[model samples]
Target: METIGKGGFCKVKEADVRVFRELLKKSTGERVEVTGMQHMAVKVFNRNVLKGQKTSEFDPFTGCLKMSDQLQSIMEEIKVWERNSNPNIVKIFKLYNDPTVPEMYLLMEKAQYGQIQIDLEGGDYLTKRNAEIEVVAVAKAGVHWPQGSGTDLEKASKWIFYQVAMAMEYLHSELKISHRDLKHQ
Candidate 1:
């Protein structure tokens, strides 16, 4: 398994899985069995991480998460992901929750594009901790980045902004759900 991303208590790994799809047969009013393979990102959440954490008897919503732990939150997340089907949202295939195991696996579609890097105006690319940071140093008070020549870059940035905005709008309007944990990775 290839590790793709990481979280506070979990890590995502990429793996190949076999899937079966039912296709409609035009000639015979029947469905055809089709086998396919897909690359899936599995989120491995370790419940053992809660060992040292203090979980109070009084399940207050202050910081203890209303007495419910990360497991409950993950379950709720799985339900939301399983219900929603959109182009902007990543598709969740299956969730493996075993009582005997300390880890829970959440299977999801592998995202191809992680982050977009556009050389704005004159930003210096700084490689730090496996992530690239574009540092824009303004020399003067009225100076700005993305000077006139970056027309194509402006369009691409605008397009990305629109797509993210649309996705957020769809989640709020159509699904009536809000993503609490939004991250770059």
Candidate 2:
């Protein structure tokens, strides 16, 4: 699989659904057939990235030095997203937890577009995490309207805001998960 994107502790790769099915079949030795588009995103997380982080649960029998803040966040994300089945949320197809390896793969449905970004006024962008994507370009037909009227743009913006609000509400109210700092790419 080829890497499509990368974050602080994870690399997202484009994987085919058929390939994933074969992987599962090889591991479980059970024949499986899947009918769908052969497109998905697999997030690979390296557990050893934050190996030096210390925690309060340090002990001899069961160590706690690996229980870092980043690791905890990663685990929580997987737990929450894997259990949810909402229309506004991303669906987790499968979780490939390699017991012998130091990495984990989260197979999920791929979105049609890339990460959303806001173009800053001074052209510097908001912290440089996301690419400078023009709002006008994303708005599609909303930008082209009759002169002296901003109703279309306003409606489009409101629609986008509403979609985001719905996703947030699903995450917070239904899943009890606070999506903190969903940075752009």
Candidate 3:
């Protein structure tokens, strides 16, 4: 079986439940449940594009989008956890390599709750009231200050900015890698 995603990659059926379950146990070092299982994504790389590819810096939105290269980028992201640990970042569990197909599968921790970013900013997705309610809830959750006194939103925002800057500083100065894309999302 095969499946495709918009502007992404192709995927083929990798394994059935029994084999996959055993594979997950071996990889994760723990018994786990895999649900909504589907074909693993495989990048289709172009030789012509590879010929001129010399830089790591590339526009993610436009011009000769290479799926294979993007998969490599994702792999690099997984590798970063080996060196640095950050609570804000997502954890990648394992990497599955299929020599026959030349495809890699990244098994990651699945979040039971839907992404807040998608809930809030998903295209034409949030209605007015929903946005307002989410904003209020976030605002309430964000408050922190002197023992009892509640901090203002600006203060909270500044604190968040500082924490993020600290993380970037550590990454750049210590890890020697630039985040490149740093924006409030």
**1-185, model 1: which lDDT tens digit per residue?**
77766667788887765421111134224432222436667788886664434432333445443545656666766787787767867778766666688877776777655444432332345322212211111222223344634644455446555666788888888887787666542
User: Any idea what lDDT model 2 has?
Assistant: 0.66
TM-score of structure candidate 3 = 0.46
Most lDDT-accurate candidate? 2
Better of 2 and 3 by lDDT: 2
Q: What is the lDDT of residue 9 in candidate 1?
A: 73
Could you list the CA RMSD of all candidates, in the order they appear?
10.2, 6.8, 9.3
Q: Which sequence of candidate numbers ranks them by lDDT, best first?
A: 2, 1, 3
TM-score, every prediction: 0.64, 0.67, 0.46
**Model 1 vs truth, CA RMSD:** 10.2
Query: Model 2: per-residue lDDT, tens digit, 1-185?
Result: 87766766788888777787788688767543435667888899886773444444344566544355666766767888887877656678666666688888777877555555433452544433232222533365356443525776566556556666898898889887778766433
- lDDT per residue, candidate 3, 1-185, as tens digits? 22221122333233454565677578656554555643233233333333344446445567654444545565465577456665544344455554455445544433222233333343444523333323444464575333334345456556556656788887887777788656443
| Alpha-carbon local distance difference test for all models | 0.58, 0.66, 0.48
- Pairs in clash, predicted candidate 1: none
| Alpha-carbon lDDT of model 3 | 0.48
Off by over 4 Å in 3: 1-68, 101-103, 109-116, 119-121, 124-151
Error of 1 at 40 (Å): 1.3
